[model samples]
Target: MAYRPAGLRTMDEAQDMPPQSPAPAGIGVRGWLRWAWRQLTSMRVALLLLMLLALAALPGAFIPQIPQDPAGVATLRADRPQLATWLERAGLLDIYAAPWFAAIYLLLFISLIGCILPRTKAHITALRAAPSRVPRRLTRFPVRDTHTTTATTEEVTRAVRRALGRRFRVAVTPEGISAERGYLRESGNIVFHLALVGVLVALGAAQMIAYRGQAVVVEGRTFANSLVDYDTFTPGSMVTGDDLDPFTFTLTELTSRFTVDAQARDFAARVVVTEPDGRRYEDTIRVNYPITAAGANIYLAGNGFAPHLTVRDAQGQVAFSQPVPFLPEDDFYTSRGVVKVPDVSPGLDQLGFTGYLLPTALAEEDGLRSVHPQPNAPLIVLDVYTGDLGLDQGIPQNVYQLDTDNMTQVMDGAEEVKVLLAPGEEVELPDGLGTISFESLPRFAAIDLRYDPTLPLLLISALAAMAGLSASLFAPRRRLWVKTTQDEAGHTLIEAAALARGDDPGLQRELERVMTAVRATTPTTPEDT
Candidate 1:
């Protein structure tokens, strides 16, 4: 054999080795899938997915959602048809239910599960094992101390064990004593991720089984908990009519207050609710303060005026007599509304009216404008149309808008007919069609009812996540070592050092504290080496 140094190879031996081959072939489908899964399950991907979910929800806040505000969406579509089309196509109007948003949410959920399982297994293994063995060279640690004392090795070891046992998991051997603590740091990290997964699951359940409905109830009118009673109802995938609580509520009164400059000050809606068990109670709904009825939350969403009107045909038969809600158009309560009289007498064309209601009517140079939000001088300015009102066509239509596409505008001589009437005023329709009367004006309340069984779980999970995150951020993970040796002078030489998993500002202080505990047990003062 050639005289080769230990751990050395000769030229012939090196040449016999296999050459570094060209880059391996492309990873097969299975390998590629494994790589993808690993990448998707990484913490970085989970955080990125979370961020994407948050960003995707932003559009729902700014744009009008069909489930929440169909009227606003209708107006948007009418005003900006192109933009509305693009938004609808891109799912910006209904972001939370979008397929892409759901994909990110599902991916995040899977990633959290994937990360938690492996880490939890490892943590269990670590918990079963003892503290790591003492390092060969304790002097290599940044936080270190040495004490020369008259105490024997046995005394020094006992004191060190006693002191460190209070807070750390200690392991004593002939070489040294090894101690570790702050397992809760990793535990809290795992707990935080688990809590986040719980939150996501709760939220998904809520989305799948919850229901929300909105109804505009005029004062003295009853609203029943049924599909037909709601002006807008958005039900989750698993929700149905039977899922709604059987209840009935009537808006008894709605009070409003406004500042001099037409700024709204306060609004309250008093309602009488009848539960499914026949229990009746009176409650008030205010902005930001919701009332519970039949196990569902009733929120006061809006308040406006509904004018009580009566229409009579030429035969003196009552055609339409009910309150019609006029949606507000401006801060001053300049409202626009429509009335379709589809039940006119035989041989007479249906009647339709499109008009504006000025709460505090003021005759300006251009036209009538509202000066305040209060109904101090309520007036209605309407234009009459006579033809098919489109109610019997089975196609859903917006109640607040009038479709004059198949109707003819009533005319007086050479000009289009327009009627301006105050409260309790009666006006004769041109061409002997009918007589319209504005009887009274009563306030209406837009009440929203919501039900979700997973709300409490979601709340608890969110709070737990915050707590676990706090523990993970503040708790410190550190390892400590205490070694004892005999010096030439026959005194015990104690050496202690600490190593932390991350930056620990109190590491040096901890070393000092352990040293102090040792000094207190020894008979002689500690001498620095």
Candidate 2:
């Protein structure tokens, strides 16, 4: 039993109603599917799907993805085998190409399209229609005012119609004068949603025709735009080996400058670019600037040190000698690398050396460390290993690592020899096995070439979306009405009201302005009217 107001019903009357009944069964399979479709196309579902898509892409930023950095992914697997295996199996390492991520964004795209088409149709119909009818009770509106004037009803009505017609969609109905404005607000909302759909479509299409790859080139070495020349390559489904660009570039020199704290301040790579027509041009590549040629971009990603070494066997015959690029370990460029001279003399053991190369060698408490990134004084400290290198077993091995699982440590008696060498210096092995020489020092450049035809379309669609958002945010929708009637003294009484489609604080000021104009401009006397 509920308490009642003056005009409310009693408890007995409320209890007199019949009891509610349950809904009938048998909505059918078709009806259930229809319900599911409606839910999928709803705005709430669309927003949820958009959020899910963003969440799915978060892992890509932290994880080493296979498509972008296969070498990094391989290194991750070697460093943390179990974690990398689980992430790879779950497709976290390839988030964009994952099925679940694709499902979320594809559903979001469909949902936006479904939500936009109906709103577009409604807006088009509203544009073709006339202004709404004047309300029966104008004073009941949120913003309404009444003004009694000596002017006649005809003069007041004519003046209201002419004045509002200047800025709004004016209409003079038999009931009263009605005007509405800001139809572009709804159109902007529709355009914004449609542009989102365009962006999604453009990105999806771009993935099918895009191709990107990375390569590492030592100074004085040239890299060609071919699949065999790249250290890592990721291409679209439609891209073939023969479709690679015929352009080539040679890394002639690389220069890097650093601050006192060992932080890199500048990196530049000088190269001679050759076109397919045999025309060559020399240029320098900076960190912010990338070279664009043959419909692709070449970016300078990293710079590292490569040391030239000469290895010889017992017969003094040269066995393995080349410039090996060392991976940087810290800001000061303390590098670590492994050298494998597999082809020693026959009936002899394979040679392997793993060590650290310091650019500016400084003696630390524990061992040698790097104090700066510059090549003021370079040093290489290594530990020699011999025996089986497992090269002929057909197992792929990283060039920067030597598998010492089946190898034996070579030593001078019981202690391993600390083989250290500077530029132009040479050292002989402990067992008279061979000699190693430290030759010239060169820098390597890491370059990435990427080609995507849909970049321009993506940029245009993104700009369009922003433009639509600006239009929607600034344009406000409003409805105004001017009602005129005769008062008890036979004088004309003019009333105006305003209602906005959404929250608009300016409606009150607008209503007051219209009322003031009607009062001042209306004919005072009937003859003057």
Candidate 3:
């Protein structure tokens, strides 16, 4: 080398180095967006999104939903303020409608469509297209065989095509016959994806028109199909006031028989329903069974006691009279309730009472315990109060609670004075306040109403998904080629080969079957290797 610099590499050294082209350009915004689209549409991403959707539903399973239990949400907030604050902030109480949950739902939907559309189109194209062209070397196939035949090339080609045409997509040429079978493998895949998408769409449509609610129906009370009749109603966003079907039903009676261990063994409610068309019918609503009427199903969820009470002021005027349903606190049906008489004598004060009902009261030494669930020996105990009663300001109060903010407890200074009365008994207050009576113990049923128009469609789609999955898993795709050529002795040389779409274990067997069938028609040698 003539005067090469010390730091410079010689030609041989340069030749040994790998070629260095211009630095690869970074992808632009549009290119990056295309890359992201590909990633989002991939089956792996769709599977991940499905898993995320499942995880998003977990909170709904664990948390007490606000729509179903509005009062319970309030109770939780009061019980654990900080945890309630965090849960509310995260929308865990309303998991289904939360923005994050909807986002996952929508993403999974889009990913499934993106992952399925192109594959469906490709399958359709393949179905319409001709069988694959014959390869150059027949011996290259996984299963191949050659046999001698005393027949012309044209005759052999025509015979082979005719044989395979019955069961496969067959194509014939001067040199060979090419055929493909089992198009159902791809068809099943398409059906599986399409069915899954249909299931999702059907569920979404059902959710839009469905409504579920809870109603407390006491014995001898008629409940009409009205928004006001429901104790807690959660209607779909698309529901309107006019959508109600306008049917009515009365809870005639509720009967129950409990086990010796205090667990409920059997409960039944007799109901009489009136349809919109002036038709009447009798139905029984049980714990697991539902009563269906006018596209709505009524489920008997729970049962409790409602103490029928009557109260009179000092002037003997009826102040309050109704069945106040008490919430059960234990298995023995020991329950609590509230009563507020806001329209009492204007000069003195309004009266409020907080009380508990025992199904079968124990002796004083037993300390406020209930011995049974039946109301044969029912007792009501109440602590009275009197005050300004805040009804004028119109703040909503829970029917199960008393607002004691502007009230004075009617007590004996240090000990709270309580009135205990058995069924059909009355007690006169200590002062010129009122007279309280426990009239009867009538039971109430917590009934839930649900309606969905697309439930049948969802069921069909789910079945279709299962069927398609079975077909896709069990079907296989395969191709076969047969060639006919002349040997030096002027005799026909028959060659047959087979290839599987994947690693099919039955490819050689299928090849043997076809070869034997074709040879049976020809009455010639058909050797299988």
Error of 3 at 306 (Å): 1.5
- Give the per-residue lDDT of model 3 (tens digit) for 1-529: 5896688997899999998999988998999999998999999998899899888888777777776667678768867989999999999988877889878888888888998999988888988888888888988776987777666777666666666667688878765888998888778777888888888888677656888888899999999989999877887757876898999999999999987667888899999999888899999999889999888999999889998888888777788899989989999999999888876655767889998999888867657778888875788889999887777764444778898999999987788989898888999976878798988889999899988887788888888888888878888788998887776777777789998877899888877776665565455644322
Clashes of each: 0, 0, 0
Question: What lDDT would candidate 1 get against the real structure?
Answer: 0.89
What TM-score number comes out for model 1?
0.78
lDDT of 3 at 414: 88
How well is each residue in 331-426 modelled by candidate 1, as lDDT tens digits?
A: 999999999999999999999999989999999899889999999999999999999987776556888888888899999888989988899899
Q: Report lDDT (Cα) of residue 198, candidate 3.
A: 89
Q: Where does candidate 3 clash, by residue pair?
A: none
- Candidate 2, clashing residue pairs? none
Ordered from best to worst lDDT, the candidate numbers read 1, 2, 3
Quick one: best lDDT, which candidate? 1
Which residue segments of model 2 deviate by more than 4 Å?
Answer: 1-40, 45-108, 148-168, 172-176, 182-184, 260-263, 364-366, 412-416, 469-475, 486-492, 513-529
TM-score of 2: 0.79
Every candidate's CA RMSD:
6.0, 7.2, 6.4
